[model samples]
Target: MKFISWNVNGLRACLKKGFLDFYQEQKPDFCCLQETKMEQGQADIDLGEGMLEYWNSAEKKGYSGTAVFTPHQPLSVRYGMGKEEHDHEGRLITLEYEKFYLVCCYTPNSQNELKRLDYRMEWEDALREYLMELDKTKPVIYCGDLNVAHREIDLKNPKTNRMNAGFTDQEREKMTTLLSSGFTDTFRFLYPDLEGVYSWWSYRFSARKNNAGWRIDYFIISDRLQNAIKRAEILTQVEGSDHCPVLLELDI
Candidate 1:
């Protein structure tokens, strides 16, 4: 099965930039999106027949949100981690299939001045606990903008970005903690030493032109699903948003 994840920045803007054409061309079995930045009924998007579309929109308009599009119907679907406070932003959506659970997440960013670092850390803890609980029932396929460059190799200039939101030590450590709990970073599993490949780039400074970006978006699966990962890819060339698509082909 082919699975893909992307942080579209804004679904409305992405669609205007040929998102539908790109979606049709790729034809993934399942797709997850983060940072939709839209509210319920704000815009209507026709995904066509045979595709199931599910969205969790934030209460705050044009803010954090996530969505999932799948060819197969899930046995069950859930929004958020069952926490009232965290559920409001619509940052997570979980779909349970026969074999596994697919979790689409848009992790909270620490912000430019690290003002939200404390809250981001809290989110990490809660998210870790949620994933662990789900894993006990079945293998999990979690993907989307994790908002952290786990290692130096994940960003073009890690040294200079150390203090930045996504590359900060606190954020990186949280990712470490997540992976330590029996989850495999799929891209790293396939390309252990690959460099300069990134999924998200800044809109400022012509970052994409210079290929200066961060591999913050990812497809992370439970340890048990590691052997099922046929191929993991970063589709840096295909773009409608600031971030490009990351693909994972699994033999499920």
Candidate 2:
């Protein structure tokens, strides 16, 4: 199966900037989007005749949201981690398939000056527990904009970005804990030493033009799916939002 995850920043705005063109070209088995910032029916999105869309839009309009588009119908669909505190953001969606569970999430950002670090930490713990429980039932394909640079090699200016929102030790360690607990970061698993490639860039200071960006988006699978990984790539050339698409191909 071919899976694609991207943080469109804002789906409505992205549609105006060739989002449909790129979607048509890839035609992935599963397309997951983060930060959609809009509700279902707010846009005229027609990926194709049979493609089904499952959207989790924030109660607050024009804010954090997620959506999944696929031709396959899931056996069951779940919104959120079943935690009241975390369920309000529309940041998570789980689709239970015959063989695996597909989870798309937009992790909470720590925010400037670590204003939300406490909440972010709470979210990480809840998410980890949620994923672990799902893994017990079947292998999982979890993909989305996790919003943290796991290692120094994941960003251009690691030293300067050390304590920033996405690069803080607290955030990075949470990612480390996730990977250590039976999940595999597919891209790093495929190309351990690969560098200079990223999925997200800031609009300021010519970040994208200078290739100064961070690999915050990811396709993390249950450790059992490691052997099924066929292709993992960061589609740097694709443009629409600040983030480019990340692709993962599995032989399952």
Candidate 3:
């Protein structure tokens, strides 16, 4: 099975920039999106027949949101983490299939100067707890923009970017805890020493042209599925928003 995740920044803008073409060409079994920046009724995504679409829009209008497109019909679908504090932004959507759960998440950014670090920490704790709870039932296939560069190799200039929002010690430690708890960072697990491959780039300063970017987006699966994972990649060539898509091929 093939799974792809991307943070589009804005779905509306992305569609104009070949979203449908990419969707049709790749034809993944499941396509998860983050930062949709759209509200209900605004998205009329028809990915042709046999595709099921699910959206969790933020109440705050065009701010933060998530969506999922899958050919496989899930047994159950859930939105958010079931906590009002964390549910407001529509950052999470969980789908339960026969074999496992598919979680699409858009993690919050810490923002410039670490403005939202405290709230982001709470989110990390809550999201990890939620994933752990689901792991108690079955394995998980979680994907999307995790918003953190867990290690030095994840970003081009890690030394200069250290202590920044996504590379802060606190955020990186949270990701460490998550992976140590039973999840595997699929891309890094497959290519631990690979360098300069990134999924997201800043539009400013012609970052993409220089290939300066961060591998913040991910497909993190339960460690039990490590052997089942076939391939993982950062599609740097594909473009729309500042971020590109990450693909995962799994035997399961």
Q: Which prediction has the highest lDDT against the true structure?
A: 2
TM-score of 3: 0.98
Model 3 poorest ten-residue lDDT run? 38-47
lDDT of 3 by residue, 1-252 (tens): 999999999999998999999999999999999999997568566699888889999888889899999889899999999998999999999999999999999999999999999999999999999999999999999999999999999999999999999999999999999999999999999899999999988989999999999999999999999999999999999999999999999999
Instruction: Report the error of model 1 at residue 202, Å.
Output: 0.9
lDDT of 1 at 171: 90
- Return the number of clashes found in candidate 2: 0
Best by TM-score: 2
lDDT of 1 at 31: 89
2 versus 3: better TM-score goes to: 2
> In what order do the candidates fall by lDDT, top score first?
2, 3, 1
Per-model tally of clashing residue pairs: 0, 0, 0
TM-score on alpha carbons, each prediction: 0.97, 0.99, 0.98
Total backbone clashes of candidate 3, pairs 3 or more residues apart or in separate chains:
0
Candidate 1 structure quality by residue, lDDT tens digits, 1-252: 999898999999998988888888888999899999986467777678988888999988899899998889999999999987679998999999999999999999899799999999889999999999999999999999999999999999998888799988889998999999999999999898999999988999999999999999999999999989999999999889999999999999
| Candidate lDDT values, in order | 0.92, 0.96, 0.94
* Model 3 whole-model lDDT (C-alpha atoms): 0.94
> Which sequence of candidate numbers ranks them by TM-score, best first?
2, 3, 1
Write candidate 2's Cα lDDT for 1-252 as tens digits. 999999999999999999999999999999999999999999998798999999999988899999999999999999999989999889999999999999999999989889999999999999999999999999999999999999999999999999999999999999999999999999999989899999999999999999999999999999999999999999999999999999999999
